[model samples]
Target: MLADGTIGEEELRYLADLYAAEVRTSDDAIGSFLDGLAERGLLDSSIVAFLSDHGEAIGEHGWIGHGIFHEEILAVPLLIRFPGGEWAGRYSEPVEHIDLAPTLLDRLGIPIPEGMQGASLLPLLRGEPAALAPDRMRVSQRAHGIGLSFADAPGLRIYFRRTPSGPDHLEVFDLGADPSEEHNLAADPASRETWMPRLERYLEWTRSRVAEDRAFRVKGSGIQEEDKGMLRALGYLGEEE
Candidate 1:
C-alpha cells in the first residue's frame, strides 16, 4: 500500500476486511484451545493475556505501517483474563508496554526488579483507581531517530525527527484538543517555552540510559543486491536508501 505513496479507498476496505477475518479466525482458535484446557481442568489456575505490540495506521496520517507517534499507531489493545474471571473490568487509563512485565510479576507475587521503570497494574486490576502520577510522561521511539515525547498532565505531545546531518524537526500538538495531531503548536512561543524544557530533560535521561547499557549495539550488515531488490519490491526500503 505504501509503495506508490497512495492508498486507494477500495484497497483500504479490502485490507480491513481481511484483517477482520483473520481476527475472527484467531479468536476461534484461542477459544477452542481454552475450552480444551478448561475441560481438562487446567485453565482454572491460569491467567491469559491478549495484547499487541502496536496498532496499524491503515490510512490514518497517510501512513500504513507502525513505528510512529500518531495515536492510531501508539494505542493498542490489552485484555487480561484473570483466573476465574476475577476482577474483570475495563480500564480506560493509558499504560505503556513496559508495564506488562511488572504487572505479571506482581500477579505472580514476585518482586519487581528495582531498575524497572514501569509500575505494576495490580491495583487497577483489583478495581482500585490506580492513576498515573501527574508528572508522568510516556515516550515512544524508533531506530530512525524519531521520537514521541509527551506528558499526560500537560496534554502536550512532541514529534521529534532527527536527521543525520541536518537540524532536527519538531512538531508539537495538544492532544487534549487535537487528538488527531492536525495542528502544529511547536512554532508558538508560549507552547515551546512550556514543553521544550521537559522534552530536553527526557532526552538527557534517555542518553544517560543508553550510555549505561553497553550490552547491545546496533550495527548494520551489508545487504545483498538480491535482498535489496526484494525489500524494494516489498515497499520497505526506498531507492534513496
Candidate 2:
C-alpha cells in the first residue's frame, strides 16, 4: 500500500518464485514416477496417495514457516487414489494424518493395532454411512499454544495462545461467516463461556497422550540387549551393578 491507497507490486518476489520452482520440480518428479508406473502397466493396480505433512506460510500473518496454528500452516491437501480408482470423490470432513495409516491397514486387510488415536476412514471413503464421531476433534498444540476444530462444529476454529506476561489470548472464528477470521468470537463473554468449557475434555486427552508418549520415550531410551555390548565398549553404557 502507498500514500495514494494503491497496492504496490514493484518489488521482486524472489522467495515466492523459489517456492513455486520447488513445487514445479516436485510435480515433475511425481509425474515421471507415475509415467513409469503406467509404462509398466501398474498404474491401475497401484494405490497412490498424495499429501503434505504440513503447510507453509509465505508472508501471511507476518510469518513464513510452518509449526504454527494458523489455518494456512495447518491445512494440507490429501488425495488418495485406490486401485482401479475405486471410491473416487472429494470429501469435506475434517481428518488428520493419523487416519492415513489406519486407512492403509484396513485396505490391505491387516488388523489395526489397538489404542491408535485415529480410526479407519474406510466408510467415508467408500461413501457409506458413518457413525457420528462425538470425540472427533482436530487439535494442534505446542508448549505455548493450541488450536482446535471439532467435527460436530465444522467451519469453527478456536485458538489459545499463552502470552509471556499475561492471560492466554483466545480466538474463535466461525469460518462459515468469517472465512478470514477477521471477527473473533472469543472476545465476547457469552461466546467465551460457551467455548471455554469445551476445552476440558480436549485438555484431558492431551495430558493423557503426553503422559503415554513420555512413558514410551523413557522405555525407548533403554539400551537394547544386542546393542549393550557395543554401547558398553563405546562408554555409552555402564556395567550392570
Candidate 3:
C-alpha cells in the first residue's frame, strides 16, 4: 500500500475485504435503524443524512495517519436521502468538510449567516454539477507548544501529501493535470499565471472568516516578566527585551 513493495496487494485486498464486511453490516444496521424510526412515526418529516468528516487513509503514499489535506483524508463519503419520493440517490461531486453545515441549514430553509465558507448541497442533490474543478482549497497546520517534549523551533512545512491530488492538499497542486500529484508543480513557474490569483483569493477569504474561539485571545497567561526572563535565559525568546 505504501508502494515500498514490502506488503503485497493481496494483503491490502484482504484488509479491504475485512472492512467491506463491516461496511455491509453497518449499512444494513443503518437501514434497520431508519426503518425502526419510520415505524415510530419519526422518519416521515425527517431529512435523513449521513456524512463522515474525513476519509481514512489505508496506507496510501507511505502514510498511515490522517490530518494532512489529502483527498484520502478529506474526500469523505456522503449520503443524503430526502423524506419523500424520487430524490434518493448518490451525488458525485467535490464537496468539502465545511459544506456540511451549510447544506443542512439550506435544506431546512434556514438562513446561513455571513462568513460561512461552505455551500449548500441542494445543487449536488438535484443532479447538478458541484463543479468537478478545484473550486476551494483546504489547508491544515499543526504546531507543538514551547517548553513541551519537542524542542521549540516553530515547525512549519508543507508536504505534497498524496497521489491523485484532489480538492484537499497540504501544499498546492493542479488537480486538472497532476491529479496523481506525482509532479511537484507548486513551485512551477508556469502555474503562477494560472493559479496564483485563485490561490491568493482563497487564502484572503480564509483569513477573513474568523472562528470565535480563535478570535479571542487567552488573557490569563501564566508567563509573566520573570517567566519570560527565565525563558530568555534559556534562549527561548530573541534579543528583544
Candidate 4:
C-alpha cells in the first residue's frame, strides 16, 4: 500500500479509487459499443478479442507499475470471443501473446507461417482432439529481470535480475505458499536443485535464439514521433512499455 513514496495512505486510496472509476467508465463504454453491435446483429458474425500486452502492479511487492517480474504483471488474461460463440469456455493453460496471431490464422483456416514462433490455440478453443501440447515452462522479462515459471505448478517461480551496482540476483518463491514473495528460497538446496537445471537450459536456448533473431532482423528507420503518439492512443507502446 505504500508503493508511492510521497503519498500518504489516504492519498493513495483516493488515487486508487480514481483509477477504478476510470476503468469502470471505460468498461461501460466498451459494453455500450458491444450492445450496439449486438443490436445490429453483427456481434455473432465478427471475431472479437480483448487482451492486453502487459499488466499493471498496483502495490504488490511495493511495485507501482508494469515491467516487473511477478504474476500480477505477467498473468493477464488473453480473452478471445470467437465468432458465433464457437469457443465459449475458459482456458487454464499457459499461453503467450505471440500465440495470438497464429490462433487467429488457424481460426480463419489460413496456413500458419513456418517461422512463426507460437502455436495456435484454435484446437484448444474448439475442444478439438489432439490439443496442443501444454507448455511446461514460461519465461518472461523486463528491463532488469527475467522470470520463469511452470505451467504445471503455477505457484512456483524464479527470477534472475541484473543490478546496476552489484552482482546479479536470483529469487525463488512458492507463490502458493508465499503469494507476497516474503520468503526467499534461492539458497535452499532443495529449491535450487529443483529449478536450476531448467533455468540453465532455458538460458542457453535463449542465447542461441537471441543470436538467430539478431542475425535475421531487418533494420528500419524506427518509429516516427507521430506514429508513436498514434500507437499510444491505440494501446501498444502502452503495451510493451
Candidate closest to the true structure, highest TM-score? 1
TM-scores for all candidates: the values are 0.77, 0.73, 0.59, 0.75
> Per-residue CA lDDT of candidate 1, range 13-127, in tens?
9878887897799789889988997999978688888778877777776677666667777778887877888777887878877788888898999998999877788887777
Alpha-carbon lDDT, every model? 0.73, 0.68, 0.57, 0.69
Q: If both were scored by TM-score, which would come out higher, candidate 1 or candidate 2?
A: 1
Per lDDT, what order, best first? 1, 4, 2, 3
* Residue-level error in angstroms, candidate 4, position 150: 6.3
Q: Candidate 3's error at 33, in angstroms?
A: 1.6
Q: Which residue pairs collide, candidate 3?
A: 164-179, 164-180, 165-179
Clashing pairs in 2: none
TM-score of model 2 (CA atoms): 0.73
Best by lDDT: 1
lDDT of 1 at 174: 89
- Candidate 3 ranges beyond 4 A from true positions: 1-18, 123-134, 144-174, 196-241
Q: Name the regions of candidate 2 deviating beyond 4 angstroms.
A: 1-13, 131-154, 163-166, 204-241
